[model samples]
Target: MKVWKSVVSAALVSVLLAGCGSNAGTDNEQNEVKAGSTVNLKVFVAQPRLKEHYDKYIEQFKAKEKADKNIEVNVQLEMPPADNAPQILKTRLASNDAPDVFALHAVNEIPPFSKAGYLEDLSNQPFVDKLLDSVKPSVTDASGKVVAVPLETLSWGYLYNKDIFKEQGLEVPTTLTEMKAVVEKLKAAGITPFELSYKEAWVPQLFLPLTVGALTQTEHKDFVEKMNKDEASFSDMKALFDVFDLVNANGTDKALEVGADDGAAAYATGKAAMWIQGPWYAETILKSNPDVNFGVAPMPLNDNPDDTKINLSTSTSLAVSSSSKNKEVALDFVNYILDDKDSSAFYEALKFNPVAKVHTFKSFPWVDDALKYVNEGKAYQDPKIPQAVKDESGKALQGYYSGQLNQQQVIDALDKAWKSYNKVNK
Candidate 1:
């Protein structure tokens, strides 16, 4: 058995594979080593609740490594509490005890790691050619650099209970007006209409991407640019606020009383009829109650007839660590997760939409529909913004939810933070 399959470096360059090096002996020679040296790889991850997603894949990788190269791969999946992963990672890096590979949320976050000289450019990884064009931007820098492998493509929607819809005699609400009506219907039927976890604060930022989605569709394709330039504010979200009033209208305050995990529980238990969440919640929902019927729909358009924000754009990406000693391995790993059938299957099992177009899903029509969302010109990714603004805005929303700040106060906080972000990020 060939332990390490020889990777002949081609023109693509996501990782600097040895075969591509001009003087690294020959590809075949470089693929192997003497009888018994240890070639171990350590990985760090910040994505919580994804232990199962990586555990199995790492097993496959390890099996291949041992069979092909007499190499022993030591993989450690570390998901610091979601809130603390970055801080822990920074602390570890400072101590020079950081894992060779790690996880990050977006490209802007990647730049900081890259600037610290901790990542390898992934433009030429083996799987690069297999990615769907729609997902390319998720893992890319402004200069077209593929700094990391994009593991999944995500979209936001109301993860709702079909059972509740049936019990309430409600169909999928086609528009924001319709959704509001549905919310009222659910409330009258004694079901809490929405699940919101304002304690975590980041819950509302989910609305930001979707709100901007609507804004882009209606009167301002440059809303993101304006936000980035600090010339605009979340104040433009008044119409979207209508959805919030509808959501919280009927004592959904229980949502704010608990953390996100419990809020998810509230919905999963059939207490709450709807939850506007990313695909990440699928696992917990299934584990808690596989019998519950659920469906996903993009955020509905604003109820006001004159409103124009029709698109709801949400996405996720992956970036490579600039500090890997095994750039080839890192790139190969990224490719497998992004595009390979087996790897994509693993992710599909994890409930994330694969970024590659290759994994044709004949069973789940919804997955296919989500992929076509961008092609239909109905949705898009937000223009890259600064982390500070994202964080502070999330904090502001949390404050508003807790009544610690009024709507105006939230807007003021967001406006000031965004202006500051523009100065530093730009």
Candidate 2:
């Protein structure tokens, strides 16, 4: 488990794991469920908000398995709290208590999990051919093995109130200058320019992927690789603060006290004209206010319009555990996740963008808004930044918001986190 331990440490330097076995099981084992036997399959996901959707899907899968294979599956579906999920999952993996099938952020988690031989190779699965070409690379490991099922094909930046923008006679900004003007206009019209949700570090941490993706794809080419090698510094990307500062300064009041759900409520109720969040929370926001007219747009990172681009990514994906005794049933369940007949409905129910060729449901307006950028070639793949660095940025941004740390301190913290990640990973 030394390699698994290193993966966890490199990705989360702050969260330590006890060492265990690096391998889950040998590939020589023929893992399958006996016909007519009841199998207990464990399925873990980081999204607790979509428990109902998953429950329904699992029931469907159970019925399908019973009818097709004469096998009964009692799925133990686990949806843990988001903040503690990564730590909990790492602990479970290190202790050799891995789930049969689990969900992870494809680009961030697949590499390490595959390197540790925790993920079963899924390249030859039926769902592989069903995946869209755009999302294939996301689920593929460094060695080119398809290791996961793409679940959330994402095109995101900032979620904005379309109706508010219309009422204020403001259009989505295309550059830093236009964005500043839009902020001022919203403020002058007695509207909060942004929704700041800092109680959960991950919410504020959204800036890292959005900011880093856009800049690295355009002006800051090779920055991610350089940072990974400890050859670059966040000090060089100080332009990020131009928007981060404006967002924090113009956001709603009592931001530090507000968590993501509360922030969604405020945004849905028009407390702010815009929120720097992804469409993944649209379901939550609609729950708060179903009529909220939201749209997604690329955040303007700099004066160059070319620097503003949507983030195209497969954010969440499903993978089978190689160590599972019931790999047959687990892989069957994973393949069924993208079943042509049911996948579109499931993705539609979850308000997620389609990732597979089988998904034909029309996406929400906000998703379409973001996809317009993707369709027009104004999008960049989400950069592969260490999870530890993203976590550090979230904590650092919270301090930046509280005036406990200045811009330089935040930059220094990120640089240090990247260096620590490189050390452990190397």
Candidate 3:
């Protein structure tokens, strides 16, 4: 499933490390280390929110490596802001200053990075066989080469406060019409209908996957392929404005000033009944207010009940840079992420969904809430939309919300972006 393909973008490569060129390692840096030698490994990831958990895991890996191999591994973790990470990483890779290890959205990033000869082929790694069947495809390239370690396998949708829903006697809506009714009832009962954080282009841009996934899977089956071929237009799916307009009209005020972190705090505190977000932020939400009773539900995209399916996919994944001087140590760390004995606790501590067979922890209630739809086959794999197109959609939607553009202008922008992307990619 392409669910997690482009969900989270790749992280930045620290400019401070630019002095350490891609070929910085000596001839002896190739993993056959002498006893008591020290190896420095630079690691980068997109989610700065999970730094604490990652730090703990790296410490454990360090201690274990010292004990088992008589070698010291110095791991430098780099986490830049998510909004600009992808562009920075692109520049880093182009300059041959790639990190030893980094996180990327598996499906969307792997192919391009692999074509650029920037990714190591992990198809033969020990952890490849241990991945869950459902998640294997996300990290596998067209040649069946598994290029990354899949981390987050998400069954996500909008988050709703169970307490508020129950208190207001509201059921999860399965269509846009029902969703509108739910909004009115929530407003009547003195609760904000939605939590909107449009300050970040990526936040408002999430509507693309939620709406396009449902549409392509059912109503507009050929949409992505046609768009890729320049035979289709965004005007075909203009109905997306329905949910966009509805939520924008009823959500908490001053949305353009609010970012995801603040929006999570607002959602956790019950300032709004629903938030159009994925479970990837559950860690941040629970940290802000542990007592918040929340559950995941499909975002209603249209009047058709079938279009309200949950989004099931993978998010961030770990990969070793093929150009790294310390390939051996980098691969070891990637394998360590899926270690049979330590992985369950690691994933659970991060509140990430299980992505490998070694994961044995019980999932949170919200995960199960989303799984209820997945079990019923009421979920769709994320469509393979071009990253440039997705980026354009997010920026265009942000403009639409701020009154700088209208629906037609947004549609025209997306169509133009798609054609430009096709020209370059071809």
Name the runs in model 1 displaced over 4 angstroms. Answer: 1-35, 86-98, 107-118, 304-316, 326-328, 338-341, 357-377
Candidate 3 lDDT score relative to the true structure: 0.83
Model 2, 1-426: lDDT tens per residue?
000112333543322221314345453287466679899999999898889999999999999999998999999999986666776776676666789998888877786667666788899999999988878988999999999998888888999998999998998999989999999998898888999888887887888888888888767898998887888899878877888898988988887799888898899999998999988888889999999999999999888998899988787898887778778889889999899899899889899888888889887788778778988999999889877777677778888878887898888888887888777566
* TM-score for each of the candidates: 0.81, 0.93, 0.92
Per-residue lDDT over 140-215 for candidate 1, one digit per residue giving the tens place of the 0 to 100 score: 6656777666655565555777778887789876578787788778777778878877665457666655665565
Cα lDDT for residue 175, model 2? 93
The Cα error of candidate 1 at residue 6, in Å, is: 51
- Per-residue alpha-carbon lDDT of candidate 3 for residues 1-426, written as tens digits (9 for 90 to 100): 111122222222222123244432322235476679899999999788889999999999998889988889999999986666677677777667889999887756776676556778899999998899989989988777898998888888799999999998999999989999999999999899999997877788789888789898777999989998999998889777988999999999988889998999989998998999988899999999999999999998888888889988777899888778888888889999999999999999889988888889998999999989989989999777766667667778888888888899888878887776666455
Residue 314 of model 1, lDDT score: 28
Kindly provide the TM-score of model 2 when superposed on the true structure, using C-alpha atoms: 0.93
Reference-based lDDT, each prediction = 0.60, 0.83, 0.83
Local error of candidate 1 at 44, Å? Answer: 3.0
